[model samples]
Target chain A: MTHSDPLTIAGKTFTSRLMLGTGKYHDFTVMRAALEASGTQIVTVAIRRVELKAPGHDGLLDALNLERYQLLPNTAGCRTAEEAVRVAKLARAATGVNWLKLEVIPDPKYLLPDPIGTLKAAEILVGEGFTVLPYIQPDAVLARALERVGCATVMPLASPIGSGRGLRTSELIRTVLDGAAVPVVVDAGLGVPSDAAQALELGADAALVNTAIAEARDPAAMAHAFALGVQAGRLSYLAGRMAERESASPSSPVAGVVRLPDPEIPA
Target chain B: MQVNGQPHPFTPGLTLHALLRELAIAPERVAIAVGDDFYPGGQAPDCELAEEDVVEIVRAIGGG
Candidate 1:
C-alpha cells in the first residue's frame, strides 16, 4: 500500500493519497523535511502577508518550489462569499493555480465554516473554472450539495480546525462517504496516526493533516508515521472486515455428546 | 499624513516604508492607494510622503 496507488481528482492523477497542510511549522527547513517524509504530492497553503521583493520578508514561497508539489491555495481567513471569491481570484493571479481550498469561517473563536457563504463561493468558483475543494462540517446533505456544484472534492472536518479532537462526526462522515460522488477527504482535527487510520478505515478517500504533524515533538518522524498509517488504513478498508457477534458459541456441541458408549452405531 | 484611515504627524521627508514601520503594519498585508493610483508592494520604498497626501493602505483580513 505504497503511494504508487494512483488517486485521480479533477482529471489530475496523484500518486499520494495523503494531503498535507503547510502551517504551524517551526521553520521552512523542518516543513520541507516533514513534507518529504510524508510523501504528499498535494500541499495546502494559505495566502498571507509575504513580502515579494523585500530582502528578507520571510518568503515561504521560495522554500516551497512549485515544481515538486502542487500548491493548493486556501481562502482560510475569508468570512463571506464575496471576500472568498476575491481572495480566490487574487490567489489564482498570484500563484497561477486554479486549485482552491475554499474555507469561509465567520466566527473568529470557533472558526467554523459558514455554510451559506461556502455554498455561494463554491457555486461562483466552479462557474469560473476553478477546482474547488470545500472544507466543511460532516454534513451529508452539504457534501451532496457541494458535489452538485461541481466540486472537485469534499473535505469534511474530522473535528474543529486544529482542535485535534479527532472524528467527532463519525456518523455524518460515514454518510458522506456512502453518498458522495467525488472524493471524501477527512480534513482537519486529526490528532494522531490512529485518527487518520480510523478515518481511512471508515472509507475516506484521503486525509488532510497539518497541526498534528507540524506541532509534533519530531515533525519528520510524525510525518512518516502518518504516511504509514494512511497506507495501512486504506489497505485494511480494501481487505473486507468480519461482522461482530454479541455472544461467543463453540462450534462443537456440548449437551448432545453424552452418548459416547454407543459402539453399535453404523459406520 | 494619513495611512490606512489613521492620522499621523507629518514629517518633512517620510517614506511609505518608514511610515508603515511607524504604524506597525506589515508591507505585505497592505497596498498603498494614493492620488487615484494603486501601488503594490515594491513601490512602497521610493514613494515619498507630502502634506495632505491622501494615502489608503488596504490590509488583508479574514473575510469570505
Candidate 2:
C-alpha cells in the first residue's frame, strides 16, 4: 500500500507497477483523466509520420504533463530491426527521452512482435545508451537473450495485441519469470484488471495496459480499478499462497471431535 | 525530395527550417529524419535537406 517497495527498472524506481498506453482514447480530456486515475508514472506513445492537418497528432504533446508522467516512446509500426532502430532514434530525438518500448510487429493481421527484429533492435538501441524495453512473444529463451543483450526490461505479451485475451501464454510467461535476471513487464492483450493482476501475481515486475482501459465504458474508473488490481496482486504475491493438496483439509482439529455413545447395543 | 512517402518539390540547398516554413508545418510538433540523419524538434533548423533524401517528419501519437 505504501510506496516503500518501488519497482526498479534500469536503476529507476516507480511506485506504480502499472504502465499505460496513450492510445485509443476518445479525446485528450478522457486520456488525461484516465492517466491521472491510473497513477501510472510511465506512459507509452507511438512515433509515426505526422500527417499534415491531422487532428490527434497535435494535442498529445500538450496533453501529457511531462513533470507528472515519463513519456516512453514506442516503435510500434516498425517491421524490421533497421526500421525500429530508425524510429527509436527519431523518438529519442523528438521526446528527448532515451527510454524506448522497442516493438517490431511485422505481421499486421495479429500484430505480433517479431522476435528477430525485436532482439536486433534491442541490441542496437542498448548499445546506443538507450534504455530499451523490448516487447516480444511469451518466449522464455528470447526473454533471457534480450536480458543478456542489455535491455532494461523484457515485455512479453500475454496474447495477441488488442485481443482482450487474458494470459493465453501464462505458462510461457512463468517460464520467462523462472530464469529472468531483469524485470519482466507483461505487455499487450490484457482484457481486464484481473489480467493485469494475474501478471503481477505470477511474479511480473509490471503490466502495461491499453485497449482494456482506453475503451472501457468509463476509462478513468477502469484505470483506477486496474491500479487497485495491480496493488492487490502485488500484495497477494508477497503474502504468498497455500500449498495444493489432492484431498480436502479440515479447518478444525479432527482429533478434538467428541465421542458419542452408541444408541444401539444393550442400553 | 520525398516527405512522408510523398514526393515533394525539391528546393535547392533547402534547410529543414525553411522547408518546414514552406510546408506550413510547425517545427516544434514534429521530429525530422533525413534518410539516416535524425534531427529532434529544435535541432532541425540548421540541418540541410538533399534532393534525393527521404524525409520522415513524425509526431507523438497515442499508442500502447
Clashes of each: 7, 0
Model 2: runs farther than 4 Å from truth? A53-57, A255-261, A265-267
DockQ-derived CAPRI band for the predicted complex in model 2:
medium
Off by over 4 Å in 1: A2-4, A50-56, A249-267, B1-64
Q: Residue A36 in model 2: shift from native, Å? A: 1.0
Per-residue CA lDDT of candidate 2, range A22-100, in tens?
Answer: 9999999999999999999999999988775453345587888998887899999899999999999999888889999
lDDT of 1 by residue, A32-151 (tens): 999999999998877654233342345566677679888888999888998788767666644567999999989888788988899999999999999999989888899889999999
| Clash pairs detected, candidate 2 | none
Best by DockQ: 2
> Of the candidates shown, which would achieve the greatest TM-score relative to the real structure?
2
